[model samples]
Target: MPPLSFSEGFAIAAGLVQLFVAVVFLRFRHGRPEWGLGWWAVTFAAAGVMNTGAPVLLAAMHSPFGTSLNVLTMVLGISTMGALVAGSRLYTGHPRPGPWWSFALTWLAYLSLMMTRQLWPGYESLIANGVTGLIFAYLGCLSLGAMRRESGAGHGIAAAMLCLYIPMVAGAYAMGLDQVELRYWSAVPFALAGLGVMSAMMGRMRAHLRDLNESLEQRVADRTHELRDIISSLESFNSMVSHDLRGPLGGMAGLSGVALSALDAGDTERARRLFQAVQAQSSNLSNLVADLMALARVSNVALLKQPVALSELVQESVQHLELSHGEGHAQPVQVAPLPVVACDKALLRQVLVNLLGNALKFSRKAARPQVRVWAEVREGGVQVAVQDNGVGFDATRQRDLFTPFKRLHEERDFEGTGLGLALVRRIVERHGGRVGAESQTGQGATFWFWLPATETPI
Candidate 1:
């Protein structure tokens, strides 16, 4: 092809720049939901088309058609100002210029020029160009205000608007004095301004993506740690259960065999004693097995939530304690009315049963043994308290309370597997509740738990 004309070369360069900006705009369109930035992209792209096409048309046409094209360019210029105002308003969170006023003012200005063009064709282009330049200058001031206020996307757009307007301003000044070539170089800065805005938007998007990836990685790490803790707990539980049950079960079997042999040898008294010892050992073994199973079930069972009356649970626990200890031997226990809560009824009852049982067992030697159950309403939940005037444990020994097989008293003094409170804690926590105790040396102990309240059905 032959060497391209000035207008043709400028149009080709502007078109290429427009294509690049259009691609950038499209790429980030879905990623950023900010309306100001979106409008800026659309305005810049449309301006690019007008800038590229106008010059080519001016070069190809003459007289009336050329004049009409110039008028169309002036109209596009007014639209560019309106877009800038609206975009700035969005970025700054300020009230937008009324649409009706903007439309009326812009068209009124253009119509005055149209009439001027008909009356004085010679000066029409100059007047239209000056009016367009003034509109751009006014929009630039608004953009600068947005930048000063530190609006989102303001700095980048302000810089781009400044870059684009500076050349147009310079071209307008030169053109007033009949210098034409200066206006030709305006395309270069216009393209640079468009590129700058797109680059800023891309940078913001990349930062957002990086933050999202970091958050996802952190969540994965936390989940992995949780799974590891759960596995470790399960292994420890299995080891303890195996070691505890083996010796007791073996002894019961051996003792039963011995009792049978004694009876066969015709030693009646010795056989009777042996059989009694076997029965005691068998009962002990049975208790241990039952406790172990209860603990295991409590740990493994999933929480089933429903509205449970706390008073009823406490009453049931007290009745069971009374039955087990018997009226003659059992100490006086006091319980208060409680509010309803949302929790797993079975698990919560198990917790209360263990706590009350522990209190009764330890207080058997106390002169005035007492156990009290009550609840206090709290913000968003309720706190249930189980207090006992028993052989209270030391506060220093608090950590051992919820560990399996860690007994506070001797096995002879208290017949227990030392898993009751541990089971209580596990069950309470599974129901999204918390359990804790308050005690001092020789003083009474208080075990309390908090459960979230349930909303009443409408």
Candidate 2:
């Protein structure tokens, strides 16, 4: 109703500012309780309400009611301090107990004393100011320790402002200054402390964003490397198809023309021989295509893993090899107890067949050719080895053994499309395993693979 003073004008503006800050904190606090923004919002809201209400109530009610408003203001001030401290601890990841009891006890004690203010009148304001100042000092010390725990500009600023506020309150009280004068000096630092809190929250959010970006960048890098490897493999496959398939197709075409000429010249036997040569070439091409299909299948198929007895699979492979090649039936294969592994049974069977077939084929030249299959369990899982007593290859070139169409032996001595080991490698890798070979020229060779272990025994 009356003209407003400078301190009252400042108090109203500061209260509005604090209320606006509380609203902003509330808006950002959604789904982020860990940030402690909710507590900060309470701190500002309570301070804003007390600051705005105290002046209006003091003007309207000049007697005991006015005195009661002052006590209420002090009580709310303690609440704001508690909320600020709680928010600070939560933000820095060092939480403390709730300030409800302190608020309740202070309110009850002060209210009881205020009822008897006629007897103890003047001392109440001093006591209230002193108590509030001491608490603020304590909170400042807490913020100082928190600043040391976590490097943040906000904590330091809040501590400095709170600590600075104590001396101002003490000086004002000593000079017997009124509430409006006290509010004038205290409002600036209070507002700054709120800004400091906001700064700490912003810094934390920035750090979180930085970590997320780094993780995303690392994922992108890994995916890029994988895509590059896929491209390289595609290129190698195209090269092999062009070179290897063209030769066989060309030989077949040439043999067909030559046989036609022999038939025209009335050379029946020559024509028959040429036709047989063409058929052999056609057979080789078919085998190569089949191997290529298998390799592609291995790359794309999703694995269905189950416990399988690898020893049984090895025996079946040996029997099948004997039946298919005819001569390898005489080769003695010594099979040791093999561990049971979790894998796709069909794919794993194919792996055993290729490995055993190669072992028998390579070692059949020995006077007493022998093929040995054994397994060992190690820290890295189960390793199965197929060794042969045959003419071994150069160990230095062993890495190339699993490459499609890469061969160490002459075609005349050994018959193969050079894709068996490559297929073995792919199948094993698809099962989350690895394949390798060890050998020295003129000695024996050992081909080994390892698979993740299962609970099943040998």
Candidate 3:
């Protein structure tokens, strides 16, 4: 045997590397049965075999089997091309390579023709070049189509694929013409294509990782918002419990001591009055604690929605007010013909009652004390309004209206724990609604809420 050329040694080294790559691809195929990775493994392994076997056949160039080995090399080249196309098609959902039977006929012709006469250096160069060119041209089109079908841009990849055709086929044809040496350069095309395939796969893996990262980031953002909301609620609860309960509790203690002093002086009337003051303070503390508990309950309870008649709810809320405050407490409440809406009835009832109660409470000293509850149909949803001829507030402070434990009026002026409107806001928001008030100082207020119209409960 002739001594190995530099080209042969390079080919052997390349073949070993390719075989190692094939085994790695095989492992990937075992891990993930998708993407036709097995075909890639086969193609790489086959290319390694062809590269390793080429030098032996080159040494026996004059022998008949040398020609046969050359033909087998062509078959291996075609197989690799087929595998490349198949894997790409699987990866990108692009079109498949042509049917097997069509290539079988061309391969048969090449094999049979070679047996009859040596065609490598003659007319066979043209035929082989034509076949190889056609294969590459087809693959180029598939790549171009895949690039178009893919959402992401791969202009460079498409350009590289389109550029592969002419040189690859024309260069092979030049080699067949005995114009190019078959030393180290014989396996260059395989190496180039192998590198290209590896690059494409790596790009695909990168895209997949990027998508996973984006999804994880979105989840983190959502969790962060929830965390912020929880912290805010906890702060509200703490401030409310400390501020609200402390004032009334201290008043009750001071009143108790005053009543004891009055009883020691034998002033029964003064002691009785002080005892009543203590009872009032106790009631205020009780109300504050109850409001706190209600706020906590609203946060935890998931709303169960149904179709509720707003007009009827308004009338019912008026009756509740009349029962609690006096028979004529709801006389000023003028409810409009409201539209039916999908919402939690009990929650919405609380909303109407709180708003209506506020209107009544604030308008109690007004000469007329006219209260109006109306509704209107809007583009995205329904709007409900509670207008009262009462002590209206500054519009600038409207932002604080929905905040827990936020009160615009002092407790001495308006008896409340500042949780009523906050609870109303929570109930509305839970039902996919938004609340806002429109008013100027002493012009009376129109507190309104917008509820999104849904065919069914979400």
Candidate 1: which pairs clash? none
TM-score of each: 0.63, 0.63, 0.60
List candidate 2 segments past 4 Å from native. Answer: 1-151, 154-201, 211-229, 319-323, 326-331
Stretches of candidate 3 above 4 Å error?
Answer: 1-205, 218-222, 225-233, 454-458
Task: Give the C-alpha miss distance for residue 342 in model 1, angstroms.
Answer: 3.2
**Candidate 1 structure quality by residue, lDDT tens digits, 1-458:** 25666755775586578657766675666665453665565666766776566555556457658777767766676676566555545544555464335545666777777766877667665676666667656655655664565425635564655546545665567655332333445556556655655655555557678889999999999999998987897788778778778877787788778888988999889988877887887787788788888987886777788888877777787777778778644446687777878888887888888888887777767788888888886667788888887778888888888988778878787888878888888887777778889987677799988777644321
Can you rank all candidates by lDDT, best first? 2, 3, 1
Question: Distance (Å) between predicted and true CA of 386, model 3?
Answer: 1.0
Once fitted onto the true fold, the runs of candidate 1 whose alpha carbons sit more than 4 angstroms away are: 1-159, 162-198, 205-236, 268-300, 319-331, 377-381, 431-433, 452-458
**Candidate 1 Cα lDDT to native:** 0.70
lDDT of 2 at 99: 42
Give me the candidate number with maximum lDDT.
2
Worst 10 residues of 3 by lDDT: 177-186
lDDT of 1 at 399: 89
Best-performing candidate as measured by TM-score: 2
- Over 434-456, each residue of candidate 3 has an lDDT whose tens digit, in order, gives 99999888889999999988332
What total of clashing residue pairs does each candidate reach? 0, 0, 1
